[model samples]
Target: MTTILLVDSHDDARRTLATALGKLRSDWTIAQADSGLAAMSQMDDKSATGHVDVIITESQLVDMEGVTLLDQVRSSAQQPLRFTLSSNSEAEAVLANSRANQRFLLKPVSAEQLANIIERSMRLQHALNEERLNLYMSTVNAVPSVPAIYDEMMKELASAHSSLIKVASITESDTGLTVTVLKIVNSAFYGLSNRVESVGQAVTLLGVHLIKNITLTTKVFARFKGSKLSARRLTQLNDEAMRIGALANQFARLAKLSRSTTDHCQIAGMMANVGELIATSKAESDDGQPSLSIEIIGARLLDSWLMPYAVVEAVALQHESPPRNVDMLSPLVVLHSIRYLQKTFTDTTDDQQRTLCHEYLAQLVPPAVAEDWMDAFHAIEQLTAAKPPRAA
Candidate 1:
């Protein structure tokens, strides 16, 4: 039975979480502490028989702030997993150290989501203690410049019909990219039994859309290999964002909303965080990054790059309610909310959100088509996971 400490001034939250967790796992123990001091004292319980596996703390506590208490926990405890529970929709820009493997969970989190976080965090802890994985983060954080191959690929993707042959032709022209892509696809990442020997096979395995992103992002990761911050957090954020973006695009396509713009659905999802991801990488090299901090920097990047204003607005206001603009194209808010549901799974406001989804889905699509939209996202996820890597 894993023991978890819940410290927060909010009685409702404490009780609510405790009840839900207990319902989820009968043997699990949830010890309540109103303040950080009480939490530290409880941690010091000499007679405390069960191990406190993780601490679910709040950022704003009466005795001490969340991060301050976490600093102390790091100093005294045996690196117990610490999670900061808050209503702040924004994620913590800085992930917990690889050793603690802890994370932040917004309030109204579901039992399933909470359980998943706990399991992953503990596994990370075990791996750290056993020294099975290494810790590395970029020290001098410079967001690597986009690779030329990727830029050209995107330009072409945005141009005339770009078939597999066109992609191969583009790669064939660049000797450096041709070799590099072939090397990556063959690397352990893809797990191809027969190593990819050419750029064509790599592209074929990755598919055009995915290869486009890989060509764009791989160099970004490779450049920061020896840096202070590990690329894990950025990659995780991007991958998750991509999945949601793809889903959003799929939803839009089903609604028959933005077909004229080409894979406008996909474009909406892909560029939703273009500004944020790029800017986050750049800003971290300076001060410690914070969520909701770099939205403008990202927005500016997109604006400068001549992206559609609708896409920019949609990506910019990801954490807030949908903007009530007159244009129907401003579906960013709605699309973002759908993606947000993954993290915002608490039942407290689920009814409202669900109604909103239903109403919004009805507006863009018939009931049957909207149902198909949801089904498609799940199928895409499964296919993406199972599909063999794209060949060059």
Candidate 2:
């Protein structure tokens, strides 16, 4: 049975949340603790009704900060999904210290919001093969921590006085990140008349939203630098990511999708292969495959980082054929179609797979629509090919 532990110093608040959650999910056994230490004790109890599957805590505990509780829980063997409740004032500090498998919910969290979080978290956990993921994680020498600069960028962006200049300053703090941001902005994908030589310039040209996504993609790739994977292989992966990202962005724009969705599509496409990178980094040999599929691993990682649900879902489902009833132009559809088309056009020789891709698209959209998408993709490929490769 699913179990949840609610940690809060206030007796009334703790009981209120538990009662609401209990009503929402009658099957879930709700436990309560008034302090961080007590929460840990409840979790440690061998005789507890069942192992805790999730933990929700207030930002401030009588005994310790909620972040401290999060750190302890994450280090524990069970590592239940960690969430901390904080007001806007405390969000920055809370975010600064938290890592994967943890999330921060702003205070005044409604019962509905909490329920949604639980549902999504449970669904993600169930989708992943926990045993295999654990085994794979154990074998890796080091899993990248959530990038500190990324966290800082987020905090800065959330500030009332947030500015592109301040964001640029934060990016510059990490020299490697600065170089990467500049490199991507200046790439042919953006098609700027002049080169972008600084983070400030990139931010001014692309706007903060696009730059933020680019920063995240670059930082994630940077973490895997100097891994067991060869430089050539890594470079190839980076190039492919950029290509997919550019294609996804172009598709979104051509379809006139919302700016938010366009950003999601771009990032999801860029990050679709992150699982492959992670698996390759820890491979025992050059071609060794992890027991878990790249999609699951990448999804798990992205979910932990608190990525948009759509982006995470797109990555998880990138390798799967689209559901018959799914929207033809949704972010997931765009990403899946782009990835499949790119693969088929390049090196995917499986006739069965190619047939399935074509059939899926044909089922969802008219023949002409599918053809237009294909034409657009090929146009993007040709444009990309025409540009000289830029230095990393």
Candidate 3:
């Protein structure tokens, strides 16, 4: 029988999730604990027979923070599945510290949601064992990736020296390169233009500096020429990044962040997974096949780029603690997790994406504000949905 543990400081939350889960997954030997102290006492009791198969804990434990409790559990090196069930925003550090997930369950979870978590857990365990689940996390971890060149172009535009016109000519030097760059910038994904022509014109309009940066970005896209990855997944990675950048830009704007700051944040969010791009592209060209995936090549690629310590730390220890002085609202985390959410649109419960989403809603978003350009995020979502794949 599958075993599970439910730990929470609140009597209501602990009992509620336990009851819902018990009814939905009767096969589970569900165990309940009132606080971190009680949970540990239960785990310490060998009579319970090797602890619960999974431990779902709340962020505010009676004795310690959820992350502290998770740290203790991780120290034991047990294989039982672990999850963080919380309504508090601080759980992100807990989730990030736990590496895979310490599985998550938002408060007032319904029976359907409980069953879904159990099911998803089973799938993750299965995929974990097989090591070829076609997942984004794994693939991104395996290769070297560089920032999307276009993101750099934007950054340049944000710089004091930026001129869109100069930027355009540099990338347009090659006819094929020009088409690819325009396909992205003016594509439904960017929501840029109905009629953008020659690189020179694009530069003149957006500014020569902006055009130069676009050219830099075009160079990066051109690298995707021969990777063996699925057309669908590759396109998904790119679209998600663009959407994240768009969302971040909107948030920064709404937050009243300076235009330059907003632009940098936009680029940072878009290129957070850049190391993966560089690695996969190189692997594709060298082997005459796509040797790495966006999922697997992620970590190694980041390492290769010698990226900022913050990003490297974030990617390296996403499942465990790495330094992130940056706030959840800070551009990086928003984009990082949004990309994950976009990838796993299917399931929740005790899942990493769910934890990130909860943390984002609770911690990242500022006070209720409606003039939300966040719709741009969804817009890119729809654009990628209907648009043709960037041909392999």
Best by TM-score: 2
| Candidate 1 residue spans exceeding 4 A from truth | 1-146, 154-164, 172-214, 217-225, 257-262, 271-284, 290-292, 323-334, 345-369, 377-392
- lDDT tens per residue, model 3, 1-392: 67787777788756776777788777778787777778777788858745566677777777886656765775564655566656655454224323334344445556575566556455444433443423333543334244355445444444456555545654655677678555555655444556676666555544443343344334544456456655665676665555555565565666665333344445455555555565555555455434433332443343334332233333433332212332323334444445545554324333564444454544445534222433344455565567643521
- Tell me model 3's lDDT, rounded to 2 decimals: 0.52
RMSD of each: 18.9, 7.2, 14.2
Per-prediction TM-score to the true structure, in the order listed: 0.44, 0.65, 0.44
State the lDDT of candidate 2 residue by residue for 270-312, as single tens digits: 8888888888887745456786788888887777676655677
lDDT of 3 at 271: 54
lDDT of 1 by residue, 1-392 (tens): 67878889888888888888878877778788889888888888835625688887887789776767776886775556667777754323222211121345555667666765566446434533332111112232453454677667665654445467687778778676566567545644334689777666766775565455445444544454455444666555545545555566556656665232223345456555554554455455565554333443444444334343344455555565542322243345445645554444324234675555556655544666655654564465464566423322
- As for lDDT, the candidate ahead, 1 or 2, is 2
How well does candidate 3 match the true structure in TM-score terms?
A: 0.44
